[model samples]
Target: MNTLEQLRAGALSGARRLTLRADLRELPEEVYTLADSLEELDLSGNALDDLPADLPRLHRLRVIFCSNNRFARLPEVLGRCKSLEMVGFKANHISDVPAAALPPRLRWLILTDNRIEALPDELGRRARLQKVALAGNRLTALPATMAGCERLELLRISANQFEGLPDWLLTLPRLTWLAHGGNPFSAAQEAEALDNAPMPRVNWADLQVQALLGEGASGHIHRAARADGTAVALKVFKGEVTSDGLPGTELAACLQAGAHPHLIPATGRLSGHPGGADGLLMPLIPPRFRTLAGPPSLASCTRDVYDPALQMAPGAALRLATGMADALAHLHARALTHGDFYAHNMLHDGDGEGRLGDFGAASFLASVPPQQAARLKALDVRALGCLLEELGPRCAQHADAVQVLADACLAAAVDTRPAAHDVAQRLRRLALPCG
Candidate 1:
């Protein structure tokens, strides 16, 4: 949290990265002093509405975060930064993104919670692009030119006005994760899911948070006790759009997913926060469980990183795969897609007792045409295939059946992958492992 005072005092002279959260409305002149050394600059949570031409003078800058501001336009000066590759302007009022503002080296872009009605055609010209977070925008359709983003992998277009997903999106060659809930097409279906759910809704004041359990891109989880003294894990959502989508939509998906033995036991959402913040209540995860793998780093981009020394036996791997497959099938039955399905969203007891959680990136599939729905579900199959592929090296030898099934799940032709129900059934019929 470097301050203007610290920068002016020359205390941060050699810093490579800088972050300032002191209600700045404009760029500080002192910031240019370290342009030669700065690679990242974070001025998020400020009152800024615009950027200065001098901002581009930070020639070595590779990343910039100006979220939670009042900007109505993306500064054109950004287009001049030679080294800039990652840009985040989350929660801003930005409605205009000039084609000239995007750097050629750009790989990641986040514009969640903005008023963007349309994206420039040049967006597709950035062939190096990989991750794009465009949730909560006004976009009715993506520029057709984006079909050329062959290197693209993860995308979040949730809470937008798209009536149908672009057909070319499924053929992007590398797209794996997608979140598209809370849009006009899915509004009625999402409403139906919420209304039909038998989830218990509790008043906010009835709960008392005891300790923080964890936090994610969208919310904070805590260990809490209800008015009746029942122990529960509470997830209080941040009141804004996230890299995934809206918090309310996530809460609804969690409620609609209902119960599955292989899924975290969620009770449902609670109402009546003093500030009207939405929250989800669930049976506390047991201490024996832990996340299966670490989240992706900047270099790995979208792939989860696992422990290099970790190992698994064939039987254990089979058990884990079966459990996850069952959970997916359960969600499939509910017409929901766990778009963010990954090792980072999984928990295990290290003995094959695993649970699938996190609906922040989940979406409803009932609103799309059957062809689109098939594509959505097939995307999940690819995710499952990725999970199974990770299980391969963990064992002394790849289970032939698992490997073959993985190959089928990962069929380059999106529609060729088997459905989740069939995958689960097949996993059950596999012979007992040698271990």
Candidate 2:
């Protein structure tokens, strides 16, 4: 946090990044002194409604964050920042985004937890756009022009007012992660699933909370035990508008997932949190298990990062890939899309055995036409391809077969990618290592 006094005194004259969170109502003119060097700025938790048109004077600015503010409209001057690539306005009162408010060089845009109902057509014109977050808004429909955003990958339109899914969204070649729960279409599908197969319910008081295991954008997972002294992993959702979608949507997907050998099954649903939050009781993962890789960092916006020294035998690599493909095939069979399919979401025991988890970005398939649903399945194939690409180089055995499978999975033509079930079968046919 850069103090206002330091800024005014020119102590931060040539700073490359500046963060001001002193409930600022306006930016001091002195900030302009660093125009030549400033590249990132964070003005979150402030009271600003607009920005100075001269903001463009910061010729090298590339990222800006103004979350938790009082802005009712996106600052139009932002579009004038020629080098801006990332913009975030989370948890604001923004209700309008002018046609010219988007930066041409934008790659990542986050407007989570806002009051916006629509987006400007100009959004589609940015050829470099990739990641987008519009969850927890009042949107009724998406701009048709967004069909041109061919480079778009991750998208979150959950907790909105949409009555149907659009066809163009299904055809985007690079779209991997998509969350659309809390909308009318999704709500109806969830209701039907609950009516057919409800999850077992467990009261909160019956579980003894122990230590926290991990936390994510959606909720916290804890190591807990039942009143009967049975150990379990408990996930207590934040029960709010997460960047991906609503916690309720994730819970619904969990119930519908049923059981699979490579999936962390939900044994029961949590009924009571003192604060009335949604939660799940899952089988306890082994203490020896750990994440295979880390989630993408801001620098590697859409790719997972792994340890460079990590290596695997051909058989071990094949085993891991087979399990993931089988799990994904199961999800698609149940009309569910594991939107956020990445290595970081998998927990491994170091012997090529692991389970897929995290449904925060999952989407429940409903009334889409068969053709479109098949294309959506192909998108998941691409995600699996990406994971295989990461693992192939490290394997010494069956490298040729793994390369062939990866090539087919990543084919540009959606129809060219093999179905997950077929890939799993092929993997199973490969020779296994001796015990």
Candidate 3:
């Protein structure tokens, strides 16, 4: 068979998968002949709107990619594909989805950059459904039936009309991840009484200020302790503001998002300080120098600077990378962008584990101006690339593992760079091989 004939022959046969992307606006009838055995298909970046009715005959089909299409509605035939597990319809024009058009086995659904205003109540009935990405849509409210999705773990409903989070949503046992603050329906209470109220005085009797840890452009950090002897970090704001107004407020918001196992936790906000202004209370971190002055390098940390025994080793580096990936995943899942993501902003928890810190530049994705968002994401990618460069030589013995991470960091296109969740998955996979 010639090249075209060979491709056509494969489509006609009982192939388990197919990925045809050569100026095909519509699926040829010949493609349906293998429906029974086809388990995966990729017809993305095409002009197809609806699927052939025979597509439901693909009983073994598990995944489908129909993104970047012109579909106004979901193809009803998908409901018959009982084995369908995932569907990627991002960057489409889909405005509505009939509950009956979805398969019960569907688990991961990606409908980003669509015009969907609402979902049917039956959407929450899918027992196995776990992750749902609905960013860049027009959702006004989530169906209350969503509470029935007991297995749902990650949800991204940012840029919607939610004024407040659904009460039932907050109670879901498996709903550990959420990012929906942009919607009008999800508006949180503002920082009230700030203007009339006097600045809160720091309870010095309840806390002890220690030595200065470091100084940033906007603030100075000090190691501090509570009256009960609990250790914490104190960040006193500088009197002058940079081009951005009130950097302290932004920092406070990032900290209020709370601490992840892989993120340094901010304890509380403190006012009335030695600098004559408000400051932040955070967890105290032992001083550990990172390779920021030059290309990514891991120099031997001296005992006087920080406990040499606590320094990160090869195994520890792998673990720290994995943990940091998860932390980034959490932030990304919530549509929160960490403007700066270098090693300088990450803190080791004394046992090789690490947590993301310094959210002074962090912002909700939708809240950031479009041009600024692009710049921030690009900067983050550069930082990640630098990190990979640092890890590459140290992990030279595991070339393939190192390359995988480096490649993710160095993806040519900003949009093509792996998301935090994808990075975490890759890191986990690399860890197994490196070990």
RMSD for all candidates, in order, please: 2.6, 2.0, 17.5
Give one digit per residue, the lDDT tens place, for model 3 in 1-435. 112355566634767777766545777666666766778888887788888887876678888889888999988788788889888788789997998778888887878778889898888888887777786688878888888887665566755555545556644544433444345532331132223223334565567888998887558888889877888888877744321223443453454455577776656667546545767777655556342222122121100122234344666566667777788767655556564465666666434467677664454554444553443344354445555565455453654675676676655444556666676677777776545
Query: Who is ahead in TM-score, 2 or 3?
Result: 2
Q: What lDDT score is found at residue 182 in candidate 1?
A: 81
lDDT of 3: 0.63
Tens digits of per-residue lDDT for model 1 on 1-435? Answer: 788889999999979999998889888899999988999999999999989987878989999999999999998888888788899999999999999999889998999999999999999999899999999999999989999998887899998998878899977766778999888888887778667778778888788889999999889999999988999999999967788988777877887888999998678677898888888899998898888899887667778999886655456777788889989989989888999889999998877778999998888888787888888888888888888888754534446778888888888778789999998888767624532
Instruction: Identify the superior model by TM-score, candidate 1 or candidate 3.
Output: 1
Cα displacement (angstroms), candidate 2, residue 278, comes to 1.6
- lDDT of model 3, residue 319: 60
Ranking by TM-score: 2, 1, 3
Q: lDDT per model, in order?
A: 0.86, 0.87, 0.63
Worst 10 residues of 1 by lDDT: 392-401
Per-candidate clash tally: 0, 0, 11
What lDDT does candidate 3 reach at residue 99? Answer: 86
* Every model's TM-score: 0.90, 0.94, 0.50
